[model samples]
Target: MTIVLIGYMASGKTSVGKILAQKLNYKFIDLDDFIEEKEHATVKDIFKNKGEIYFRKVETQYLNELLALSNDNIVLSLGGGAPCFGNNMNEVLDSSTATSVYLKGSVPFLSNKLIKKKIKRPLIAHIETVEQMTEFVGKHLFERIPFYSKAEKHVLIDNKSKPEIAEAIIAQLF
Candidate 1:
């Protein structure tokens, strides 16, 4: 079975996914990293050079490729905005062998985390203050929650360590 982790940026999808995969003996794949390796360019570079439309198109293609894998135990972490675009969330929901998990975090919790790593995030890279980050995250998360809520499982991530989050996911899955 494939376990797909979907959440806002910095909600620990990648970190918790690595731990979850290790514990489950599944291969771990971060969709952004996978795209970078396949395209020979970073996600930031793709956004900068090819623009978001191209990036979203390729992202959906790669996402479908990963979801179509048969008889593989995989832990896949999606980009923050992946579920919100196109029919990606429906595709994930429709996968027979895939289980989707939403890593849920509050606006304040996500904003604080995002503020520290805004430089690495293409969408909010220009956000310089906590207030701006909070506002941006609030609006974005509001719009994306409908898509994310379709996940098979929901895991609260605020104030939780990566190991704890992984264990929570394991409990939910098993």
Candidate 2:
């Protein structure tokens, strides 16, 4: 079975997913990294060069490719916006052996975490302050929750270590 982690930026999907996969003895795949390897460009460059529409199209294509693999026993960390576009959410939800988990984090938690890593993120790189980051997370999260909430499981990630969050997910999965 595949464990799919979905969430907004800074929600710890990639970090916790890595730990979760380790504990479960499963392979770990970060979708964005896979895309970068496949396309030979960073996601930011994909957005800049070909634009978001093209990126979203390729994102769905890659998502489908990953999901269709047989007996992979993988933990997949999706891009923050992956499920929010096109029919991607439905595709994930319909996958017979995939369990989709949303790493639910509050705006404050996300804002605080994102502030420290904004330079690595193209979307919020220009955010000037914590207040602005908070505002951006709040609004963007509101828009994405409909897609995120469709996940089979939801794990609250506030005030938790990565291992603790991984444990919570493991508990939920079993």
Candidate 3:
């Protein structure tokens, strides 16, 4: 079965996913990277040139394509907003072979982790201060939890190492 990691940015989806895939001997795929390869453009470029609406459509399209694959023992790490847009959440939920896992983290923890890499994140790139980052994360999480909470399993990531988090996820799945 496919294991899909869903969570907000800096929730260790990619890092934990790599470890999880390694332990499970599964192939790992980051959905954003998949989109970049398919579109021949960075997600940042797509958002800059075509706008968010266009990018969201492409994200949904590619997500559908990935989910349609019959490959098993595959681990997919989704973008932060992947589940919140369109009917993507439902698509993930409806997939019989896909197991969705939410890498849940507190707003304070996420904000602390994201602050160092804020410039890399287009959505929160313009956020100026830690206070702003914290506030933004709090509000974003409030809006996103409804979608994220639909996951089949959740692994709390606060103060956990990447490997520990991955093991927790593995425990949940197995």
Candidate 4:
């Protein structure tokens, strides 16, 4: 079945997903990359230009369409907040042959990893101080955990190598 990896920002979804896909010989799809490809812009740019609501609508539409076309062997890496909003979470649970996997990590781990990147992460970009970042990571991760915990499986990832984590997940699922 398709593997849907969901978690907070900087939680290694994309990295571990690629490794898993390679090991399993499946196609790897980052949901953000799919949206970006369709929009011809970065996710941050899409949010800035069309507003978050618009992008979310597009995302919902894409999710439905993808579900209709999915098979039992692709890897889908979802956005950090994708499963927590709207009815998308319920839809994911009901539709497709997708197995949801929550990549669990600590707030301190995420903060340390994301602090160095100046990328399309709009929410955490302005928090420059370590204290602010720590709080940001804590609050965001905490709020999202309730939703994330509903995934079919949970995997703790404590700064291990991507291949090791991928191997563990494959061993579990296969």
Candidate 4 local lDDT, 1-174, one digit each (tens): 778888988888999999999999988889889999988998888888999898899888777666666655788898988898788777778865878888888888778788877355767778787677888889888888888999888888877888988987887787
Pairs in steric clash, model 3 = none
Clash pairs detected, candidate 2: none
lDDT score for residue 67 of model 4: 62
RMSD of each: 1.0, 0.9, 1.0, 1.5
The positional error of residue 98 in candidate 1, measured at the CA in angstroms, is 0.3
Best by TM-score: 2
Cα RMSD for predicted model 3: 1.0
Candidate 4 pairs with clashing backbones: none
Better of 2 and 3 by TM-score: 2
Off by over 4 Å in 4: 118-120
lDDT of 3 by residue, 45-73 (tens): 99999989999999999998888886667
Per-residue C-alpha lDDT of model 2 across residues 12-101, encoded as one tens digit per residue: 999999999999999999999999999999998999999999999999999999999757999999989999999999999999989999
Backbone collisions counted per model: 0, 0, 0, 0
